[model samples]
Structure formats: C-alpha cells, structure tokens
Target: MTDAVQQKEANTRVAWIAGVGASAGLGAALARRFARGGLSVAVTGRSRERLDAIVAEIERAGGQALALPGDVTIESELAAIARQLVERGTLEVAIFNAAGATRAPTLDLSAGQFEAAWRVTTLGGFLFARAALPPLLATGRGSLLFTGATASLRGRPPFAAFAAAKAGLRSLAQSLAREFGPRNIHVAHVIVDGGIDGERLRTSAPQRVAERGPDGLLDPDDIADAYWYLHQQGRSAWSHEIDLRPFNESF
Candidate 1:
C-alpha cells in the first residue's frame, strides 16, 4: 500500500459500543464520549432507528459514528459485526453494554425467562468478546469493557433473574481479564451501583427519580466518563473492576 494509505489507516481508530438504546441512555453516552475523544465509533443494537439517531447526533457534534444494528444475543450477527469493524477501521475499544432482565417474582419467572436473561447479558457478552478480541489483538492494544449492575454483587427481591445474569457476566469479565491482561488487553467490569438517571428510569419510574433528588441517580455521562477513563489507563495501573454510584447511594 502507498504511504498515504498506510498513514490513513494508522490515524483511524474505532470504538464499538453494543446495546445502545435511547439517545439519553448510557450506551449512547459512551458512543458520544469515545467519538469526542477522536475515535470513530460504531454503535450496534436491535433498533436500527435508535442507532441511526445516535449516529446522527454524534455526527452533528463533529464526531464520526456508524450504526451497525443487530441483536447482541445472536452469534451470527456478532460475527458479522466483527467483520464490519475490521473493514471500517482499527478497533481500539469494544464495549458490551447489552442488558436483558426483567423484575418478576421467582414463581412468575419462567425457565425461558431466566435463560433469556443469561443469553442476552452473559452469552451475548461472551460472543461479543470472542468476536471483538481478534481485531483488538490485531491492534495489540485494546480495551474490552462490560457494564454490570448492583445485581452483579447481590440478588435482591424480584431481581433474582437479573442478579443471576449480571453475576455471570461479572465472572465472565474476570476470566477474560485474567487471560487477556498478559496479552496486553484491558478487560474491565463496571458495576453500576445505583439507578441511572436516564430515559429508561425517567419514563418507567418518575416517582423514583423524584425521590432520589438532585445527584441521587448515576448520570449516564458520568458513567461514560468512567469507561473512558478505564480505556485510557496505563497498563501498569490498570483496573479490572470498578463500581460507580451516586454520592448519597449506599454501598
């Protein structure tokens, strides 16, 4: 290849964020954060419209972004995303933020419901990491970040299914970190310890939002900032797991 082409490739860095939803959600915030930092971002989710809207917003802010819509639970889709990322640019960061779980009584939670939660958060994370690692390894320096919840550490009432799934994901992140850290890959699991102040919570539990008062809920942008910080850390000081919560939130 010509020197000009080589230079172009060297300058191009990409960050892939999965599970993007609302424009005000954490996933969208992550995409915008990485893009603002000069890394071209590729966002994926089941909703093409949502992904496109996020891409547009990023572009409007003078950042490059592409929408690669697909279900995180599908193995085939993740493999295809890997190929697309390779074709697009050097993937310097890959974040698995897909979460699938619903609060229901233990008796009401069917086996299928329990498994579905695992498939989306745990299984999907495995597939995404498997697919993303190749490109990341090619770069020889990449960061894989997983989003976890308070459930990752404890199972509360009505959230048994969600807790189990997040716990599994946490374990997965740990294993990957142990195996990949020696290879120069940074794997981190971020435990979001409080309710997020975003579209989902605001729409679903407006009353809860009010009860939290100012700075009670975790800000999506602040969460995104944490991810960004993790990705930028030096190898010697790398952190494998971190918990984020509001100041007033109990541990």
Candidate 2:
C-alpha cells in the first residue's frame, strides 16, 4: 500500500459502547450496526460470559470486536478499559448505556434501592465519560452519546429513583455538551421514549408485544443509526439532543 493508504489505515476510528445487560437486544443490535459500518468496537459490561458471546456474534458477522468485561460502577475497571483502547488507537465514539431502574412508590422505597439506581444511572455515566474523555480529546473530534429514558425528562410517581438518576444524567449531558463542543467533541443525549422489543417482553406479554407491530416498537438498530448520524455530524450543525420512539408508539 502507498504511504497515504497506510496512514489512513493507521488512523482508523473505533467506537466503544458500555453496557450489555442480560436483556441487551438493543446493545447487540447496535454492535451489529457498527460492525457493518467497518468500525472496530469494544463492548463493555459486568459479565465476561455475556460480553464474549456478543463478541462472537459480531465476529461471525464479519465485524471486528473486543469484549471488555467490567462494571461501570468500578473506576479501576473503567480506567483499564480506556487504557486498552488507547493502546489500540483513538476512540472515535463512546456511548454510555449502562443503567438500571426500579419501579416503586417513593415512600416505600429503601435506601439501597435508590442508591443502586443512582449508581448505575448517573454515577456510572459520569465515570465512563471521564475515563473516555482523554482519548476523545486526543482524537480532537469524537462523539459522546448517552442513552436515557423518558423518565430522564419527565417525573412520574412510582419511578422516583429512576427518574432522579435519569434527570441527573440529562443535566450532565447538557453541561458536557457545552464544555466539549469547543474541543471538537459532540456530546448528545438520546431519550428512548418507548418500550424496546426484547425476549422478556415476548415471554411476559406476547400479545402486547405483537400489538407493538413490526416497526411500532423501538429497535436497537434504529437507535444505533441515530448514534451514527450524530457521530458524523459537522461541528457547525451539531445536535445536543435527540428523542427516538416507535413510529406508532404514543409518546
């Protein structure tokens, strides 16, 4: 290859998306989408077994992937993942999707319950963003996307803990977007305002799941497409937030 071709290959961009939960159909779909785009991906989560499985699937589809097993709540683990990625090259995009939620009356909720939700929903995102910042800044142009829920923007009873944590994440996104935009880093928040079709829903309420229609429920691939769009946006036309829902789903 010519020197120019070699230089271009050496500067190839990679992306990392943290969080691959048990019911991570969305994450998996996003993996496939990125892989198809010819970008190497590092998928992070707490379970090595699950992460390995996802890597295998991505490789089988002719995509390059690395499985980095770690908990977002752990700082050391997050730092280690960042180091590994830096060794490979610059990270062009980082998506924070590691979060958990619980539904219950605020008056009846326990301290532990609230703490767990906050740790994953807000604290985890904070740590992940901090760990990924250096690499993004080094690249000079990158994208930081945060996956959020409708609760992040709206308050509802029986979802106080989840809502609070999500609200905090939204605020963080806004602050970071302003801080990072001048640095050539685009920070955006994605609000998923509807249910995602997954195996759990299939088994729990098959009829309702079917009623959501083929395209009536949000798909991880669709969300991944949105992420890609934001990543490719020019600095002059950057978007700070985007809301996605099923075509027929009521928001």
Candidate 3:
C-alpha cells in the first residue's frame, strides 16, 4: 500500500476504554493491545498516580496514551472528559468498564451500600453514555461497549448489591442499543463469567485464582480482542451481548 493510504488506515482507528479499577487487570492488557495497533488511548480512573503509572507503562512500550483521572460517578467529570476527547477529534470507540461490587447477604446490606454500587455500576454507565452521545453521533459511527458479569443475567446469594447493579446495567445496554442502533451507533455488553487477574486476586484471595484454571485467569488481552471484534461488526449483524469465561471454568 502507498504510504499515505497506510497512514490514513492507521489514523482512523482510536479507542478510549474507561475504568482502570484494581480488579481491571484487563484494562492494562487491553490498553497495550490497542497501543500496539497504533491507536491513541486515554485511560481513566479515580487514582491519578495509578493512572499516570499505567500511562507511563504504555508509553515505555512505544504506545501513545493519556491518563485521565476522574470518577465516573461524577457527571461533571464525565462531561469534561467527553468534551476534551471531542475537541481532539472523533472517538471511534468507547468501552465502559468501570464496575463496583459489594458482596453481602441481601438482608444485611445497608441502604448506603446498595446506593453506592448502583452509583458506580449503573449510574456511572448511564452518565458516560449520555456524555459521550453527542460526540459519538458527530462521528456518525461508533461503538459503546460495557463490561458486565454473570450477576447481570442471574441473581445469586451473597451478591445482592452487585447483582442488582449489574442487572440494571444490562437493561441500560439493551435500551441504548435499541435507541441508538438506528443512528449507526453500536451498543453492546460483555458478560465476563470468570475472575480477572489483578491486585484483588493476587493479594486478597489467592485461593480464588484457581477458579480461572491453570491458565491463571482470563487475560485482559483476550477481553480486549473481543471488544475489538464487536467494534468491527456490521450494522446488520451486530451482537448485543456476549458471555465469556475461562476454559476451565464451569457454569
């Protein structure tokens, strides 16, 4: 291919995956994948120091990245980030991966705990979608993908707070998909059924690590590859939801 054509092909691809939580071992892996593909990335989280560190790692590996620190629960922050990205240029894809979970018996869960989970998982996803709509519409084509869990599809004991929040997210994803599909924007959700290898598993509950099999755990790179595939789908054949689990994982 001609140099100009090759450069143009590279320039059109860009992705912004939000939420680099302690459990988001997948986010860093995904960031590396996108960076290797020559896409400029923006990684956001509540911790500025951690975000900066992730940016540094990406850059050191010859990838371009910007660390955007903000809480998804804050509407103003979401708006500002959206505006900043729009000002730079088109945002071809956006992945809402920020999630919060509270494991407790349903009866023991306090009002505050329930609200907090909702704020992070459900409300945060809503706010991000609302803030990003205008710019995504401006591009005339884009993808909005959410990271979900098995709780979204079914409720289980000891996870009332998290289950409710994830269920709400699933509903939101479906509603958005229907509302925006006609506008050429793809809205989808991925239900990750296995544990991710991150700080949480490494430090808090090493025994749980075996649940994801001898492969260690579902790598963020694998999940990121799935996101990339969803983004590339045609309008007619778009998939709205996908459930992924480690090979050794049962149920």
Lowest summed lDDT across 10 adjacent residues in model 2 is found at 21-30
**Highest-lDDT candidate:** 1
RMSD in Å for all candidates: 1.3, 2.9, 4.0
Sequence-dependent TM-score of model 3: 0.91
lDDT of prediction 3 = 0.83
Ranking by lDDT: 1, 2, 3
Write model 3 residue lDDT over 125-244, tens digit each, in one string.
Answer: 999899888888987898999999989989888988899999999999999999998899999999998787677667777878755458657777788888888988998899999998
- When 2 and 3 are scored with lDDT, the better candidate is 2
> How many clashes in candidate 2?
0
As a TM-score, model 2 comes out at 0.91
What is the number of backbone collisions in each predicted candidate, taken in the order shown? Answer: 0, 0, 1
lDDT of 2 by residue, 22-84 (tens): 435777667677778887888988878878888888898888898888889989899999999
Point out where model 1 deviates above 4 Å: 1-7
What does the lDDT read for residue 189 in candidate 1?
A: 97
lDDT scores for all predictions?
0.94, 0.85, 0.83
Q: Predicted candidate 2: what Cα RMSD to the true structure? A: 2.9
